[model samples]
Target: MTLALVTDDMTTGVLKTTDGERKSRTKLYWKRRREALSAVALERLADLGIEFPVVAGTMTIPEVCDYFSISRSTLTNIARQYYEELIEAGYMPGSVTQPTRYSELALAHVAMILRPSTSDQAMIIQKALGIYRAPRGAVKVHNQSGAHVKVCGRVLDEAYKLVSEIREDDPEEVWKALEKRNRHELQVLTVALAALVPNDRGGLRAWLAEIGLGIHSDAQNKAAVGLASLVPSRQQVSE
Candidate 1:
């Protein structure tokens, strides 16, 4: 019985059976790609001594715009996208009783979202925030009996603590926070290999073959070729 692993491209899907064994590397490839990208971004942040701000109390629209150097429209757009999140984080919204003002934490989050970084690093920050700072049970999982279960708020407790405790003068602590959040995507050696020979399909295939993750079909080879583009080049940067 062939198990059809669901992916955007069925032919190049994950966990498909090939030659009497389960072998597909799409997930691994993306995981490594994320790690490599995150590492580079994290190093840059450390070098720049970029400290995520800890502005306390609430701030009105003009104050936020001035401090962050962002447009009012940009803040409105991001606030709308994270409206529910802002409320849950104790940031007050404009109402009959009170004016809308954002918590310092909310402002910090907005800065994180807007920080200049590569796509993968952005994704990592978003996911980490969702998992650690989001409202209770942001993610759900299926149990052994296929019953949907809410993940505990404390699931990423360590990473959450690390992020919350990052110090201004301690760049190493900043690195640790991001690295902790990116724990699941950790695959340093694999990412190093991908970087060393990004264009060498034959070499990649050989290396993967030795490790039992080789492209086993024409469809997968095509998929692998396309996936190679996901690996960031030396010059990949935000516009």
Candidate 2:
């Protein structure tokens, strides 16, 4: 009696004899190659901070094969063996429905490892708080219209609250926020704010300078300076 094993290769399915004869040699060869590929993928996933079963959750068998340029059989075998280890180790959630959804814990771990530094955090806080102030005379114009613009009450309140809580508790949170800002916005804001406030500790002064400079220069250094000096200074007064 001949025993047959049925297998699929996505595009096609085939049957092979279980006995070590004829087509069995080719099947075994393919199997070995598949297993090697799976091992490579498993090692890469571990290095990338993907929690075992959870990382498996983030990709389908085919996706793993495609991402690592491996065969489906190897991917399936690796996932089946190590996925349980991942779950047992609490790297993956207890109940996972799909292979494409990793646990939040895994994502958090990756983010913590990838988070930025403190000075970057401070620059971000400064830029966010600094961009809401009014021009020296613009407030009078605004007051004439009965429109009182509250910088803290409006723009910076939420950001400030978040930053204060984080500065003492999780300094990394501050760096994350700063890293999210556009580089151009950050550079322009930094340069303009530096020129205006000169003193870094005062929030109100920093905000006003940032806004005044931002509007005058559209955060452009050349435009900011030109707009800043648009009004003739006392030094430029002629007798």
Best by lDDT: 1
Per-residue CA lDDT of model 2 for 158-219, tens digit only, reads 44454355435444455456568787545544544443432325453343354456463545
Reference-based lDDT, residue 151, model 2: 32
- Give the TM-score of each candidate: 0.29, 0.17
The local distance difference test score of model 1 is: 0.48
Clashing pairs in 1: none
Cα lDDT tens digits for candidate 1, 118-213 = 223333444543321233543322133422122222333433443344322254545444445554344432233343443524554553333233
Best by TM-score: 1
